[model samples]
Target: MTVATFDTAVIGGGLVGCWTALFLARRGARVAILEKGSVGAQSSGTNFGNLRLQGRFPGQYPLSLRSQAIWEQLQDFVGSACEYERTGHLYCAFDEGEAEKLEGYAKVSESYGLSIERLGREDLKHRYPWLADKVTAATFSARDATANPRLVTPAVARAARDAGASVFENIRVSEVRKSGSGFELRADPDLRIHCANVVNAAGAWAVEIAEQFGETAPLFAAGPPQFVTEPFPYFMSPSVQTIDGSVIVRQTRRGNLILAGYPRTAADPASQRVPVPPQKTLAAMKRLAELAPVLRSCSVIRVWSGTEGYLPDMVPVIGASETTPGLWHAFGFCGHGFQIGPGVGLCLSEMILDGGTETPLEPFGIGRFRSGVAVSEKFRREFDERKTA
Candidate 1:
């Protein structure tokens, strides 16, 4: 079969891949997104729809803040009504220690012009009457918001198509290679195609694919299973997290609660399909009971799991591929990619079409790990702590 040629070939149809394709095509690059499954079928679809700015590492705060800004203007960018709102996100601290952590995070995040207020007992009760009695204080970051992952991913893919990009679903990118000035990508169990550039946005699978072309990074994954309660009322949650790390509940605009914490299965290298075990559901519900007693017995009609990619340092490698000349990466986001996905995509696209990103992709370059490359002292100190954390 004769293969198609394009300016760029994106190797994953998850959120990152779709965004890369959409923006590249918008910039006049003929693009094709090859998805092993349906768009967002992987962790992209499974992720809890929380577009948050709280609990973010200080370095990532700025980039994430920009992405969150774009999220506010997503409707204007996509020219479609995206289900998103910045109703606010809160981090619940059941004790003094938890509250203390919030204080440190607040001071660190202040440079980004982000506001994080510590909530007292009365403040907690006044804001969310459903808050559990155990909740002593909460940190509120009203700048954060959420969007329906299911709705957003497909909408992005559709917008990409409308803007002149092709999306091929159920086609796995079997192999990738550097061919002269471009990239040669083989899909399906093996269908060869070529493009001027390739974007490795395969989420969890990104590590292995980059390895295939002799470009590897320390990317690990763990699947976290969660359950959601049926619609109750339009209750705003601001994102919720516990000192015990037991549960996090964010009420959707539709009144349903997106719950997490106490995921059933651990990260399994064998299977991405995670089963929400009864134990996990019970744990989530119990925590919900402790946090929002009113939702303790809130019947849950749906349970699912999502696998998140993690780098050894817990940050994303958002710019380039070392071994391949015309390749780049926008993966290993752990759980924070959604908030940073768009801005990363825009910056990464510029780097690919040109040579560098104005947003400082230098710290994120894959070349840092080359055998002869020395680790940056600052990067070393930072990563060492993340490893310990």
Candidate 2:
């Protein structure tokens, strides 16, 4: 019979939402995170765990760099490393065209003050002898890192809770509407949450809340099919990916090889089911073997996918809401949410408390959808546009 009140109500418990709650609570604001399921049970936990700095959208460099700093000092920030490592990221190319693309990416990254090492064919072979002979060139960024996706969200949520934020799991928020000067969230199990501000970081299901506030984006649900092989020798250090977006493979300390690929599999957000097609798995396996001949005989033990929202422009919507006051949106990250999750959270907290952030988030404003979304070059090459709807 009693209603809960808070300074901010964060809808979704993934990395972004949890981190937002953590920072807000740490700043002495009352915060609550409403998650439909357990924390980190969605795309935040199922992603490839890549903290790649190269080949990112040029505009995202600021936030990415800020986030990488948080990840580097994760233990001091969240009290958990989450199996993080800065073992570096190697982007390889199989032909001249892809090789040229790698160079362009490296230049972009270098312009942003990130150190990038361009490697010729011989340099790659000399450094990584296990690489296939057909590889022509590569770009290595020692700053690009990775972490255990499975461990991060839960840890961050726990930190948020430790900082005095209330985390409510299995509470599906059905509606959020302006109530008086603030907003009220209606959820399952007869729960009502009143807060001065609301944050829509709901991952794949975020659009529903946005639409209610007279905002809409061309968001579609999809997931990159992922596979993990049985334990092998822990030789591979840095995470590796092909410039063509064929496959990305990394060897964990436990010796399991994790692989993910593009042309992502379509997912049903209504059912919360992301099924990995068997053919996609086979294709990823073949590409993985071609990347490293030594892993040709590795046995895949599992395959999976997670629901993630992708916008036509391949950038997220992060900023205050246009049609409604006291509301903010941070969703539709495509597949890059994991690495920048913390920085986005920090920016959101700043915007909510200090009235703005210095992160230059103008490019990702939700208002861009009204002017006609300009498809990014990466969106065209990374996904099958026909399936975006």
Candidate 2's residue-wise lDDT over 151-242, tens digit each?
Answer: 99999999999999999999999999999999999999899999999999999899899999999898888887889999999999999999
* TM-scores of all predicted structures: 0.90, 0.98
The 10-residue segment with the lowest total lDDT in model 1: 380-389
Error of 2 at 280 (Å): 0.7
Best by lDDT: 2
lDDT of 1 at 90: 81
TM-score of 2: 0.98
TM-score winner among the candidates?
2
lDDT against the true structure, each candidate: 0.76, 0.92
Candidate 1 clash figure, as a count: 6
**Backbone clashes in model 2, listed as residue pairs:** none
- TM-score, predicted candidate 1 vs. hidden true structure: 0.90
Off by over 4 Å in 1: 262-264, 267-271, 367-389
User: What are the per-residue Cα lDDT tens digits for candidate 1 across 194-280?
Assistant: 888888888888887888777777666665566788898776557787744467778876788888774325455456665666777
Clashes of each: 6, 0
